[model samples]
Target: MTHTYKINGMTCDGCRTKVENALNTIEGVQATVTLNPMEATITMEKHVPTEELQDALSAAGNYTIQMTLPPSHDGHHHQPH
Candidate 1:
């Protein structure tokens, strides 16, 4: 399965590379990190828990990762008050 995560605390290209390498170290995981969006998209051979991903990134730096939720079918992110 593939999953996208929002990464926080990345500030440069080097930061992006560090995150990418850290995540790719996991068994059966291929990760791509982008700086502009500050996100990582991972392709895994099997299910990997979000905690594990967070742990990997934490060891690398002061980075944090959270699962990215897909946009709603209605294409809206917020509701009227």
Candidate 2:
């Protein structure tokens, strides 16, 4: 499953890299952190608790992560070409 989280305390590209690297360490987790939105989208092979993600970030730096609603697909849909 894929999870999106809102992250705080990231101030620059370096911060973003740190967050991403930290999250990626978790088993079965692939994370992408973006600076502008200050959020991380993690793709997991299995369900990983939110707390686990939080702990990883906390250990990495002065960062925090909270589970957030995934982006809506209200109107956008893909049509096979």
Candidate 3:
């Protein structure tokens, strides 16, 4: 399945590369990490646990990732109000 996660604390191309590298190193992760919007889109061969992803981010030392919100759908936006 394809997973899109909103990542925080990534501020540069270097950080972006770092995130990509970490996730790509995982056995099942085929990931593309972009810093412009601070997100990682990952395609996995199997279900990789979310904690494993968080562990990768934490190991990077400079990246702190958290789920913000999923993309808008059905022409409607979701806001926490």
Q: lDDT by residue for model 2 over 1-81, one digit each (tens)?
A: 888899999999999999999999999999999998999989999999989998999999999999886566886666899
Give the per-residue Cα lDDT of candidate 1 at 38: 94
Q: Which tens-of-lDDT digit does each residue in 1-81 have in candidate 1?
A: 888899999999999999999999999999999998999999999999999999999999999999988889999678688
Which scores greater on lDDT, model 2 or model 3? Answer: 2
Model 3: per-residue Cα lDDT at residue 36? 71
With a 3 Å backbone cut-off (N, CA, C), the pairs that clash in candidate 2 are none
Question: Per-residue lDDT for 1 in model 2?
Answer: 81
Q: How many residue pairs clash in each candidate?
A: 0, 0, 0
- lDDT of model 1 at residue 34? 99
Each prediction's RMSD over C-alphas, in Å, is 2.1, 7.3, 2.9
TM-score of 1: 0.89
Instruction: Itemize residue pairs with steric clashes in candidate 1.
Output: none
lDDT of 1: 0.94
Ranking by lDDT: 1, 2, 3
Score every model by TM-score: 0.89, 0.83, 0.79
